[model samples]
Target: MTLPPELSPEHWITHVFSAKAARQGGVIRRNLRDIERYVGRSAFEDELKRRGYHAVENAGQLIIFCNQEPIRLIL
Candidate 1:
């Protein structure tokens, strides 16, 4: 996933969960704009929602709070 142009590369991308999987230490990853064009987290979140996933964003990371289990996501 790409990052928002407004946020610099130095920023840290962390997944934020609401009621579920709140203690998974919050998955952290690099927003490598080089690998992919900087797409906003909002856009990704919307896409996930469009596919029937419950998600939200905290800072730069988009966290999909799946009901059954946390999918140790790779960024």
Candidate 2:
């Protein structure tokens, strides 16, 4: 289900990065521009660090891995 467009990035991220979601090996994909505009790059990185999660960007899409495991990119 799509979230309401009016939802703030902070609230959206909070929901996507929940402990339950993380435990289930959840992955979230978001628009890079929206994230950078609403959350700021530094704050987003800090949040990832605090949660021990990881993320990567490609083609204007930000993909977050809600786990602390090492990520390998297979091309």
Candidate 3:
């Protein structure tokens, strides 16, 4: 589908798209993120610690303490 020309990444997240192509009734997210922050292949370090997700960065992509093990990864 063609989005508005002015549409941005943040705008896309704010778009309340129906989960027609996904599972169950649907899922909606009150996105509290700024897309610009995650662009350019940046690593997701802080989230790893906050969310308990695994960190598997190849190199210097990320640097954080997960549970206690030093990890590096790009979300």
Candidate 4:
């Protein structure tokens, strides 16, 4: 799957969980701000929805979770 050239790391979305950052049960979000600022909230939400992922905005950042099983988070 090829992505648009503008969607490189610098302007990419993230969905990796860090065990070390986990507390109780959830992982810490270190890149939320970067993702929100880089991708822009509206575009990010649209992409997630188009890709079949559920999106929520919390703390002014986008949170995406796969709606289908066998979670696959793509951008």
Candidate 5:
């Protein structure tokens, strides 16, 4: 799934749930511009953790893990 251009960090939680339920592995692309609007990257990451996602960000991309399985995510 592509990240919504204007997604707020709170709304991002929904996407995480959906992706996890779908078991859709492989790159889920996101826009860095969208991410930059988050109040704080650490807070956003904390929220992700609350919803059972583990992510690593690199050069405007994210590698996500759900249930300990890698999900190729780009942000």
Candidate 6:
């Protein structure tokens, strides 16, 4: 289901992060610009920390890992 566009950035992100897909250890990708524009960098980072999740930025996208697991670089 798609969320209405009228929701605030924080609300939107919260819903996405709490969705079934996310809860099942799925990864969610979002546009970096949209996040920075609506939530601000610091606020976004704080939310991630509060949720005990991990995120990475790549190619102008923010990739969020829903579970609280140590992230390792394989490259």
Candidate 6: list runs displaced more than 4 Å: 1-6
The predicted structure with the larger TM-score, 5 or 6, is 6
- Indicate the worst ten consecutive residues by lDDT in candidate 5: 25-34
lDDT of each: 0.42, 0.80, 0.35, 0.49, 0.58, 0.83
After the best TM-score superposition of candidate 1, give how far the Cα of residue 13 lies from its true spot, in angstroms.
17
| Candidate number that wins on TM-score, 1 or 4 | 4
lDDT tens string, model 1, 1-75? Answer: 444666542252232233234444333233333313443555545544654555545565444544433455467
Give the best candidate by lDDT.
6
**Poorly placed runs, candidate 4 (over 4 Å):** 1-11, 14-32, 60-62, 69-75
| Tens-place lDDT digits, model 6, residues 1-75 | 655657798787777677777979988888888777667778888988998999999999989998899999889
Q: Candidates ranked by lDDT, best first? A: 6, 2, 5, 4, 1, 3
- If ranked by TM-score, best first, what sequence of candidates would result? 6, 2, 5, 4, 1, 3
**lDDT of model 6, residue 2:** 55
Better of 3 and 6 by TM-score: 6
Q: lDDT by residue for model 2 over 50-75, one digit each (tens)? A: 98988999999988898888999999
| lDDT, model 6 | 0.83
TM-score, one value per model: 0.29, 0.72, 0.24, 0.42, 0.48, 0.79
Off by more than 4 A, model 3: 1-43, 59-75
Give the runs in model 5 whose Cα sits over 4 Å from its true position: 1-7, 20-29, 69-75
Model 4 lDDT per residue over 1-75, tens place: 344646654335543322333323332343466655556556665665665555455676544454433444566
Q: Please report the TM-score between candidate 6 and the true structure.
A: 0.79
